[model samples]
Target: MYLYDHYDQAMVDARVAEFRDQTRRRIEGTLSEEKFRPLRLQNGLYLQLHAYMLRVAVPYGTLSGAQMKMLGDIADKYDRGYGHFTTRQNIQYNWIKLEDTPDILADLASVEMHAIQTSGNCIRNISADQYAGATADELIDPRPYAELLRQWSSFHPEFLALPRKFKICVIASDTDRAAMRLHDIGIQIVKNEAGEIGAAFYVGGGMGRTPFIAPLVKAFVPLDELITYSEACLRVYNRYGRRDNKYKARIKILVHELGVDEYRRQVEEEFAHLQTLAIEPPLAELERIKTFFADPAYEAGLSDDLDLSNPAFAAWVKNNTAAHKTPGYAIVNISLKPVKTLADGSKQAGIPGDATGEQIRVMADLAKTYSFDELRVTHTQNIVLPHVRKADLFTVWEKLVAAELAEANLDKITDIIACPGLDYCTLANARSIPVAQKIAERMADKAEEIGELKLKISGCINACGHHHAGHIGILGVDRKGLENYQLLLGGCEGADTSLGKIVGPGFDEDGIVGAVEKATQVYLANKEGEERFLDTYRRIGMNPFKEAIYG
Candidate 1:
């Protein structure tokens, strides 16, 4: 975990004090809602349908066990007993009292965390692969660069308010776990023919009403000039990005209207000019950040072995773990989806990324004991213990099982990414959580049978749940004053990223789950070998799924 120095601490403390005064004025009726809107949003506070929701940033999706415990304490002490982890690798407290907002932020600051930059039109939290330092497939650990971006973008005077929100992501692994291509700026660490490290820039990739898989703007940028290049890109967007309409303001839209060649040309022009200036951070600062992300020390003679006798444990291991760079270690994912349905026959998919206070607390303990006191949040709305020794697999599984945090579905249909739709968000037209719950309940018996499906649900067109990137994307709609859902097929957010295509007409609440079941049947019948839903869809095209749903 990256520890905050005095400078970082002072900056955060000052922001908290400033926001506390703003919160007081708002509560005292001196600051009107119109006046307080931007102020509150800048500090990661939002007035939802019923209450204020606070979003807290988890930089690079990384956290210490102590921070996780504080999060659990925050959830239990002030708001609900659980919190929802978002696709951006942040956490949301949906039931916040406006008066308690300042205190909650203070508590977060005490843990070296804050909600700053979680919202606002400025560059948001920089995210990366959860398996950053531990993954065997990575070319380099991306956390160093991501942390640099975090420091640079935080309260930068040049980009306090841009056309719309800007998101930047970095991925060192060839496999894109952080939705690298779906962000405003995506950094792919690469090596040149000379065996020197650099980055390939993917600019203007985003999903909203308009979706684009970012085009390559730069073939390669030297590692030392990463910040300078990013500044050049953001400068281009700030100057030329549309501001007349909110919907048309993103850099993605700008790139779409102006071809990739033109966009690249402008960015190159800016980069050339930026190179002359002394804007890039000192090399020593970046090296200092890298020290925080060094690989955890492992026992020298640990056995690279696993006792896989129990089928249950084996099943959990197979689904919830990934290969590690170290021979004796594994990357463990703690599934937030409830392992079983409630007494009311509803699966824990109501809010797919939610974790109870107790679960959070215990998971923190597990991290401290088994994972070098470090954990990370995945873009798929799950938590990752990135360096668990292979010898501790059974023990970790047992603890998770006892805490009811063990759900043996990672990329399967049950691991749904859902946004707080009509239930909590004022922007939503239909309910997202209930739809996720229904889909999970419908597919509980058939999860393993379906296998390796990315199911995402969004309340509205904002695509907060990233429904645009799911194998089966569910978008809630308001049709004739009634809640309905429109399904999409063949979308993926991996290394080969593509937006999903809409199937057909919308379906009512009662009909949507059945429609999903029909689509699954079509997939099962046509799938060859061990094909996933996305794999099978690619082979057969969209007509089969459209017909399965419509006819």
Candidate 2:
């Protein structure tokens, strides 16, 4: 993790003081709600359904054990003794008090974390693969660039009031774990034909009332010009993106209206001018940032083997661990899904990306003991100890089992991605969590048989759960004073990213779960040998599933 320099420290300290005053003014009625709204939003505070919610940033999903422990501490001290880890790789305290926010921000600053850019119509938290540095498939560690972008974009005067809330995601590997294509600006670090490292920029990717997989605006941007090119893209969007309608304000809407080619031309024109303005960060600063993300030392003679004698341990390893770049190490993913049981004496669903305070501390200690004191937050709302030695895999699993964090359902049907729908979100028209729980319970038994299904649920059309990118997408819609969920099929957020198409009519709570199970059953029955759920959907098309659900 990049430790804050003097400048970083000074800025954070200064901001905390500024916000403390702003908060005091709001509470004292010196500042109106209309005026204080943006001020509070920029600082990552939102007045939700029952109380204020505070979202704290986790840059590129990277956090040290100390930072993780601080989050646990914050949850314990200020909120409701738990935090919601979000798809954007941040943490949200749903039960925040207005007066306690400043103190919370201060505590976060002390740990080099903040709520800055976690919300508002500005560049939001920069997300990337949780396994960025440790993944075997990565070409280079991307956190340095993510950190550089983080520093540059934070409070940048140019983008402080963009057309809408903009998001940027980065990925170094070919696998699109961060949903790079579905961001306002998605940058993939790539090696060109000449073997020079550069970025492939994807613009206009987003999901809301309108969903778009960002097209490749520019094939390649040189390493030195990453900042300049990014500024160019932002400058174009900031200037041309529609402000008349909030729904169409995202860059994706702009790209859609203007077409990708015209958008590319505009970005290029801006890039040409921005380059001359010396928008690139100093090379020394980048190099200095890189040093902070270098791989930790691995011990010799560490064996790349796990004792699978325990069937339970074997199940967890099969689902939660990934191959590591290092010879004797493994990447371990922790499931934060709180278990639910059905009324019929069967298992139910789970919360997609939530961890209790105790679980946070346990994970922090696990990272310290097994993963070089570093941990990562996955986009799917799980935790990753990206460099656990394979020899200690069972030990880690045992600890996780004790904490109830080892669920053995990474990409399975039970591993759902759900937004805090009507339960916590004021924008939501329907309930998402209960629906997610129901669906998970319905599909829990056939997890492996179904295989690699990315099920996502969103409370409303904001697509916070990334329902647009799920293999089985569930969108909660308000129907005549009742909650109804509409199902979708064939969505993917990967190297081959595509948005899902809605399937027929919306279903009531129980009906929706049954619909999802029927959709999966359709896949399981028709799928060829070893075909994943998405694979089957892609192969056979939506007709089969649609027929099953609607008929």
Candidate 3:
């Protein structure tokens, strides 16, 4: 985790003071709501359906145990008893008081965290692979580059008021855990034939009503020109991105309107101009940032072994853990979507990504005791103890089981990622959480049978839940003033990124759940040995699933 220096501390403190005054003025009726809108949005405050929602940034999805604890404390003291971890790897408090927001900001500042850029039409939180440093597959830890971009994008005067909200993702691995291609700017740190490291840029990828998998804009950009090239990309978007209509303001829209070749040409022209200005951060600064991310001290000669005798623990280890770069260490993913049995003897799904304050505190404690005192929030709305030792797997499992956090469903159907739909977001057309819960409940018994299915839901076309990337996606919409659900299939967010396509006619809430189950049955019946739902869908295509669901 990157510790804030005096300058960073001063900037956050100053923002808190400024926002406090802004909030006070709004409460006292001195500042009109129209005037307060941008000010509050710049600080990551949104007036939601019922109350204000505060989004706090977890940059690059990395957090120290102390920071995690503070987030829990804020949930307990300021808002309700829980917080929703978002697809952006940030956390949101739904019910916030206008006056108490400053105090909350101050609390966050104390832990070197803030709400800046978590909202607004600016470069939002820079995201990366959750298992960045610890994972065995990455070419390099992508967080450093992500952090570099973060510092560059934060309050950059040029992009503060882009036509629409922009997002950027950095990844070093060929496997795209962070949905790299589905961002406004996706940078994959790469090594060329010369063994020199650089970046490959993918531009104009996004999902809203109009979903697109960004085209590769540049094959290789040298490390020295990384920031320069990034600025060029943003400059091109800012210069020509749509502003007349909010609906078409995303960079993706611009790229669509202006072909990828022209977009690349403009970016290249801007890059040539930026090169002379020397805007790229000095090599020393990046080196300084790299120092903060050096691997934690580890005991040598640790055995790379786990005794998975207990069936329950063994299941958890197999499902919840990923191979680590270091011997005897594993990347442990904590699933927040555990199923709950109600008093009526029916199972209900725990809201995906919702964690109570106590649960957050427990996760922090687990990180402190078992991992390396560090936790990561995944873009999938889960948490990761990125460097847990294999020897302590049982104890970690025991504690998580005690806390009811040990759900061995990673990439499984039950591990769904969904957004707060009509429940919290005013822009939503229909409720998403209930639909997600229903689907989870319907599929819980067959989760193992279904296998490695990624399901996502969104209340609207904003794609905040990343429904566009799911193997099976559920989108809630309004039809004839009634809530309706649309099912999408064959989408993926991995290295081979693709947007899901709607299968057939929309269904009511119950109908949608049944339709999803039917689709799964189609998969189980037609799937070859060890084929994932996605594989079978691609092999068999949408017609079989469509016929099964709609008929």
Residue 277 displacement in candidate 2 (angstroms): 1.4
Candidate 2: tens digits of C-alpha lDDT, residues 503-530: 8899899999999989988987898988
lDDT of 3 at 399: 93
Residue 24, model 3: lDDT of: 89
Number of clashes in every candidate structure? Answer: 0, 1, 0
lDDT per model, in order? 0.90, 0.90, 0.92
lDDT of 3: 0.92
Tens-place lDDT per residue, model 3, 5-60, is: 99889988998999999998998999999999988887899999999999999999
Off by over 4 Å in 3: 342-345
**Candidate 1's residue-wise lDDT over 312-355, tens digit each?**
89989999999988888899999987648779876555468898
430, model 2: CA deviation in Å? Answer: 0.7
Candidate 2 Cα outliers beyond 4 Å, as residue runs: 338-345
For candidate 2, what is the TM-score? Answer: 0.98
Backbone collision tally, model 1? 0
Clashing pairs in 2: 348-441
Sort order, TM-score high to low: 3, 2, 1
- Estimate candidate 2's alpha-carbon lDDT, on a 0 to 1 scale: 0.90
Model 3: per-residue Cα lDDT at residue 210: 94
